[model samples]
Target chain A: MAKKRIVTTTLNGNQTEFLCEPRQTLLEVLRDNMDLTGTKEGCSNGNCGACTVILNGRPVDSCLVLAVEAEGATVRTIEGVATAAGLDPIQKAFLEGAALQCGICTPGFIMQSEWFLSQNPKPTEDEIRFNLAGNLCRCTGYDKIVRAVQDAATTWQDHYMKNCHEKGCH
Target chain B: MRDFEYEAPTTLAAAIELVAKHNGSARCLAGGTDLIDQVRVGRLTPDVLIDVKKIAELNVLEHGATGLRLGAAVPCYQVYGHCGIVSDYAALADSCRIIGGVQIQSRASVGGNLCNSGPAADSTPSLIVLGAVAVIAGPKGRREVAVEDFCTGPGKNVLQPSELLVELKFPARAANSGSHYRRFIPRNEMDIAVVGVGASVVLNDAKDKFVSARIALGAVAPTPLFAKAVGDALAGQPINDETIAKAATAARAIAVPIDDMRGTKEFRLHITGVLTERVLKAAVARARGEHVDCRIGH
Candidate 1:
């Protein structure tokens, strides 16, 4: 028997610590040990983005990350996206656009979309499609999802630009 | 998945020492995009995983006057979008852009892709066509091997168990030289290549004759094989329909593909011909200092 590895990560704005087997995935650690189940697992091979999470501000499939590999890193799961009073803008737009059906893939999609919007607040339709290529939703045929992303982009741009203007970048 | 010990060493020397300490019981963990999945599937069972992501030196892309030196731990996304090396080596950039999805790209390191040594690896042909050299660090010390001779078979590489890929270096393209890469896949994204081709060409004045050439083919052999015969055919010839046809035929003759789930031997052979023609044309256009559009319709 091999020794269990101790991992500490700042998960969802909280300092979280857990012990995992060497083979334990970050997705498993989040769901089983940490009790943060918002991150789901699908197709454990990384084909499906159901286990997506923001690792150090980049969206990566949780299933593809070893729990031990994430030591001393910061992780943002779906549960961390919303504020105390409201959902994130992308999540709000997703709800407004009715972009989800069964909702199994929504968490991952939301996380990925949030990262994409951060990089490009005013993404064109083509840019949105390209950025979202890794994330898929079996439901909604992606039409409504694209619409939601576009809506989020507009909101994000207006808010970000206004904030930037207020900061006196000019 | 079986249990194992894990260690994340902050320094390159520490990472190498950890792997050596564990001997054959350890594996170097890169992006974990491929290593983790393999571990969960029981295809690999290293008793210890030496995480090398914290080694900053292994994650750099250094550019010099002659060529580029890419750290092994640099992610595909970094190579695709961030590295200046890609701007000059368009074929490598294009290949990185098509590897898996954004999430995979974020975690999949260029070194892991090369060290995985899969015949279908997207970066293999790209590096091969550009004449890249892999720098490896092991208990014995450091050594270098050409990318063209790095892989021995499926999932096999020349690296010893104690060795870790440290860096990848390739000469920058000379003036008037252009490189192009293209692959045929069943789907638009998140799929492996059924047939991949990368070609680099140096065009003389007016793009009349090829001063130098390199063509590397992937997914049709045990290793990513350079199309030396095709390169020979195009080396001194003018960019013309006749030359392209002959080069394509030459490339087709080198492949002996197998029947697999992604594609059949017959289809793979056919694609080798088609991709050869496409890449050569695009490479020629690039060699002439013109932007060659290689984007695919979804």
Candidate 2:
């Protein structure tokens, strides 16, 4: 067998490092090696979005990515989206909008929605539907999920601008 | 899965050497969407994986007199958004756009899709219609093959074990020429095609008669099939509803769809008729320098 390789990256926001087998997937490293089980695995294939995570500012399936490919990159999972104080505004909106029934597909939806809102502060229903096509939610049927995204977009924009204003980011 | 050594080569020559040295026990890795799955399922057991993603020369999309040159590592998402290619060859762009979702598109490479050699591959028809050519390099140096003849059967290609599909070359349409692609799927997104049709047409100066035509069909044969009879039906003729209907009939007659979970043979043949008619009309409209208001969703 080949020697295990070291993979260095910023996880959530903190700098972290680990030694992983060359064949180890990002999903396996996160769940097994790092004990970050928040990143769930629904299907080993890329079909289910349950293993979605942000890699270098873009959302990708953790189950499909090799750990070595993520070297010198930044990663954010469902647990990373929140702060020490409370949930991210998107999560809060999901709570307010009741976007979860079984809650299995919620994390992936939230991560995807966060990435979507970053790209377009405000997106039309069609745009949201198209962008979120990667994610599948059986219990919600995407009605409440769509509403949650819209609600989160509005609220997050307001909150972001307010923070920028207070910090004089003009 | 068996343990394997991984090498990220910086140059195409280095990649080729690694592939050559490892020979039968080696495989080139690009996006890893398919490669990783096959490895996990115990379908492929390689002693070494040569990741070509680091080779800068294998990631370009260039246009030239011979044709459009797409490097092996160029991601599908990159191809889909390239305005130059999309405006000139929407068939290729449309094929890239509908391959899986954003994540898959971002990670899937055109070369990987072709090398995987699945019968239902969405990009095959687009390349077939554009008269695309495959550029392959190996221990024996390089050679080119028309995309139509690249594959021999399911999950099998004519590529040698030491060879890599380095790039794809497709001719740009001349004046009064245009190409269009259409596919039928059960869902609006994240679904494979039941049947896909791509057609290119060259119109005479008067825009009343077709000077030449080429039609390609996918998912109905072991490899992407060229409907030469259908192309013959439309060539040197004015494209009217009646002419298009005749071409559609010819296309259906040439196709041989198989029964599968995604579609029955009858349904695939039926949809092939509908899509061929739709794309042929769209190609004619494009050849006349008119914009197509794409009505189909997903």
Candidate 3:
């Protein structure tokens, strides 16, 4: 049997350690070992963004990342999005806007949208659609999903303004 | 996917030694966007996975007076992220932005795209037209291969076992030069190219006449083609639709596509001319002024 390799990563704001074989994907590690099942597995290939996670500030499909490659990296899965008190602004927007149906792809969409919003806080509708093209929603035909992202962008902007009293450049 | 020994060596020499020990059974993992899926689908079975991202030589991203030195492990996001490269090598950025999405670009590297050597790979045509070269290192030492000559077939390249692609080197941008890449796809995003075209052009100081040009076509052939004659035909010709059409005809003539689910041979043949004309026009516009044509891909 191949020996399992111990990998360490700052997962969801916590120092995480897990053992995985070379054959296992980060998606598998997140779900099977860490019990962070929010990052769902869709195509198991890179096509589906259901396994999306923010790794080292970049959104990536977890299924495409080898488990051992997470060593010393900072990873933010869907599990890390919501705070102790309540859901993140994007999550709240997703719920309020009814951006999900079937629910399998919601986590991935939220994670990807959060990262995109961080990059371009005042994104236009075309920009949102262009940036979020990797994330697919089979149920909503993407109108509601785009609306939800727009909703989050506006709310997140307001939330930011209320806190800092000015627009923060990303 | 079969279990394999994973090795991440921090230095070039150490990585070379580890891969050399595994002989031909070891595969280098740069970005794993294509590779991990290849393994998961049982298309490939290897005994070792050499994670090359840790090696400094494969992560060097330097743009200097001479040219751009893009490390093999530098992801696509980093390539497009560099403002200078984006302006100087607009075609490279054009293709990189559309290769996958942000998620795939964040993890996939341009060097890995070259190494993957798929016929439809988005970056190859741009690499060829931009005159990029692969800097490879192996136990036998180092050698450079032009990007146009790198691939021999679909899913194949000139790289031998244990040979590592260190970086892709591009010569400094020539004066009055501009480049652009665009592909015909059925969908707006998340699709492989049907007939991709990359074009780099140099125009007269007035930007009304062609000084010289380079064109490359993808997905319409077994390998990405450096359409030298197509570019040659447009040299000295006035930068007009009629002159560009001659180059497009030449490109379409050389395209030998196969019928597949993505596109029929005739469809690819027709698109070969269309994309060539479109990309050439965009490239000419950029050569006149360092502007990126966002309209090309859409």
Candidate 4:
């Protein structure tokens, strides 16, 4: 085993620290050391987006990232998608749209969709499909997932505008 | 994966020194999308991993009147998302946009792609057609190599043990000139190219004839090859279907593809001709001030 190095990062909304080997991947550190297992690992080679996480506002395959390399970065995983109020709009939309069957690929799909919708609030069907191509869902065949993203986009946009108007910022 | 000492050097000089000390047992990490995979699979066992992303010199992405200087560690998403790069360097943009899925694009760097030296790297043909030069830093000093001549064979390049690819510089395109890249893949996304073609054409003032041209092919040779005969034949010729077809035939003649699982040799040769024609037409359209959606998809 290599010498364990302490890495401090901003995970979700909290500043966190963990001791891990330099060779351990971000996915491994998140799962094993930090005990945040929402980010799943399907194919560790990065072909599948099952280990997706937003690092410093950009989504990346956590399995392909080293723990030491993310020493000072901010990371957001599936576990951070909701708040104390309730489930996020994306999670709500996924449930309403019935976007999962076996549910192994749901976390990654949701994380990726959140990143895409953050960039393009109102995306076309083709854009949604193309943007989410990295995530694979063998059970759902992707039709429901696509609809879920569309639904989330509309719901989230409406909610955002409503909040802005209530707060007198818009 | 093997355990190794990880060093994040803030300066290029320190990185070079670390590599020199480790010699054959060190690997530079910039966008570890590829290197991490190789290490996990036991293909690479470097005793020291030098993280070069912390080095300021390897993280620059600048565009000016002279041209563009893209730091070797700039991610693919950044390359494709830059306004000037997407508009002026269309072929490079096209390649960058489709290098991998969105996650991969956010992490993979074009410099890392070139250094990986894959035979079918999506960026090589476009870089070669754009006349890009790679700036390399080593223990001795610095040197520049044309992108076309950088790779010697599949998985092989001309970098010494203590050398690092610093950045890539591309000259500004001439007036009335445009470049485009296209690749044939079995699936629409997240698939390697079976046959890739990159074409850059500069039309005359009238937009009726080819003033100058360059074409490069990928996945059909050990190293991406320049279709010199095709470019030469198209130069000074009127822009028409007949001339384009002749150039496509010339492109087919120069391809030396092997029979791989992705495609057969005959299929690759035939698709090379098809893609050459399509890519040239698109480049010509762009040169004539026509809008073309060069993004990867149907």
What digit string (tens of lDDT, one per residue) describes model 4 on residues A1-170? Answer: 66989999999979999998989999999999999998998999988899999998888999999999889999999999989998888899999999999888899998998777767777899899889988888899899999999998887887645544554543
lDDT of each: 0.86, 0.84, 0.88, 0.90
| Residue A30 miss distance in model 1 (angstroms) | 1.3
TM-score of each: 0.94, 0.93, 0.97, 0.97
Highest DockQ: give the candidate number. 3
Tens-digit lDDT string for candidate 3 (B1-298): 7878888899999988887788779889988999999887888888888999999989988888899888999999888888888889889988889989889999899999989899999999999999999999889999999999999999988998878888999999888999998988898889999989999998888989988899999998778888998888888999888888888888989999999999999999999998888889889878877455485344
With candidate 4 superimposed using the best TM-score fit, by how many Å does residue B134's alpha carbon deviate from the native? 0.7
Error of 4 at B42 (Å): 0.9
Ranking by DockQ: 3, 4, 1, 2
* Residue-by-residue lDDT tens digits, candidate 3, A83-147: 88899898999899999899999999998888887767788998998888898878999999999
lDDT of 1 at B224: 87
Backbone clash pairs for candidate 4 read none
lDDT (tens digit, per residue) of candidate 2 on A68-96:
88788899999898898899998998999
- Ranking 1 against 4 by DockQ, winner: 4
Q: Itemize residue pairs with steric clashes in candidate 1.
A: none
Root-mean-square deviation (CA) per prediction: 2.4, 3.1, 1.9, 2.3
**By TM-score, how accurate is candidate 4?**
0.97
In candidate 2, list every pair of residues with a backbone clash: none
What local lDDT does model 4 show for residue B165?
A: 92
